[model samples]
Target: MELAVRAPTSATVDDVEDVLEKKKQWILETLYGLVEQDDPPLDKEYLSSEKLLYNGRRYRLRVEESSVIEPELIFDGNRFDLLVPENDAINTRRKRQAVVDWYVTEATQKLPKRADDYIQKLGIDDIEIEVTTLQRRWGEYRPGHVSLHSRLILAPRKIQDYVVAHELAHFRHEEHSDAFWNTVGTLVPDYRERREWLRVKGSTLTV
Candidate 1:
């Protein structure tokens, strides 16, 4: 097997190899899983022809360079029409930033209400709902606030609910003990399946 590793420019060759050696088994398993995957991996290129999943439905992307200074995203029940400034059309970083800004705006509008419903159902008070550009986890709960990965808006509603419930459960139990799982199960009866879906497809939930 051929493995290509990219690390910080400052890192030594031994440092890179040591890290790869430590996670060799995991890397192999991930590669095997990619090979076995039936569905085409979600596009991370953020290009015009890319297919994007939003709220459980697929939307084809259409990028239009417009005179408008601010980027705008419109979904016409069929696909996403992204109107961007002409300068942003060819710049990957600017284009990605525009798309991510839209996603973050969407999550800010939708997720808090959904979280509020669960919070009310669980009788949890004084819970602050916020969106974050989280790289490692879906969501996390602190003493009085829950921070969700903003990109979760790309996932289906049920999956989003599972994440919200999972964090809320943390409000009661700080650790993932039986009591914690049971609490999560009580709120989301089919959580096991939902979690499995995230495990399989979550990596593709990128913008």
Candidate 2:
């Protein structure tokens, strides 16, 4: 971005600092240009000069006066750079896995007691809770196990309970028939509202 500056009359250091803060992008770009230039034979000498003036304010320009040095990117001669690129696929996968692990750990600690209570109240038997990250469903029930998506951690407590109850209902009905709806409604009368909330907010629960 270009910053247009008018002539300044007796501008102070504070005025230059203020303008620099406001035109940061322009200053950085100017600094980068100086760093990339070959004519200066860049040494340790760095300096800032007033490049322009606008509205009685001095627009200061920063010159690296030396090759750009990012300490984080420096490496021993024998070692390669370890910084992960933002767009790298493997880095993305690792970030997602880390999020899943965190959700699973938190949910396992928070949900077990609630799961046991609901199971007993519903008279369900031989059910195990397994937490995993899923793309679509919040909870699913097999013959003897309940698979809960790690995304459930993002839901409010009432909605989480509704999901657990919904799956528990599935243990008895096996399908989303009227009987299953009735069972879920018996446990959580606001099931429809909770389900709608999940549908609307599910996308925001990303890692």
Instruction: Give the per-residue Cα lDDT of candidate 2 at 1.
Output: 24
Measured over all alpha carbons after superposition, the RMSD of each candidate to the real structure, in angstroms, is 9.7, 24.7
Deviation in Å, model 1, residue 149 alpha carbon:
0.5
After the best TM-score superposition of candidate 1, give how far the Cα of residue 129 lies from its true spot, in angstroms: 1.2
Q: Give the TM-scores of the predictions, in the order they appear.
A: 0.74, 0.51
lDDT of 2 by residue, 1-207 (tens): 244666487898789879877776555334322122223222221123422211112234332222322211212333212233343333334433433454467677776455776787788787788877654467767888887776566557776787788788878888566898898888889887776655555544433
In model 2, the clashing pairs are 5-53, 5-54, 6-53, 6-54
lDDT of 1: 0.77
In order, what lDDT does every prediction score? 0.77, 0.56
Model 2 global lDDT (CA atoms, 0 to 1):
0.56
List the candidate 1 regions with Cα displacement exceeding 4 Å.
1-47, 86-89
lDDT score for residue 125 of model 1: 92
Model 2: weakest 10-residue lDDT segment is 65-74
Q: In terms of TM-score, which candidate is strongest?
A: 1
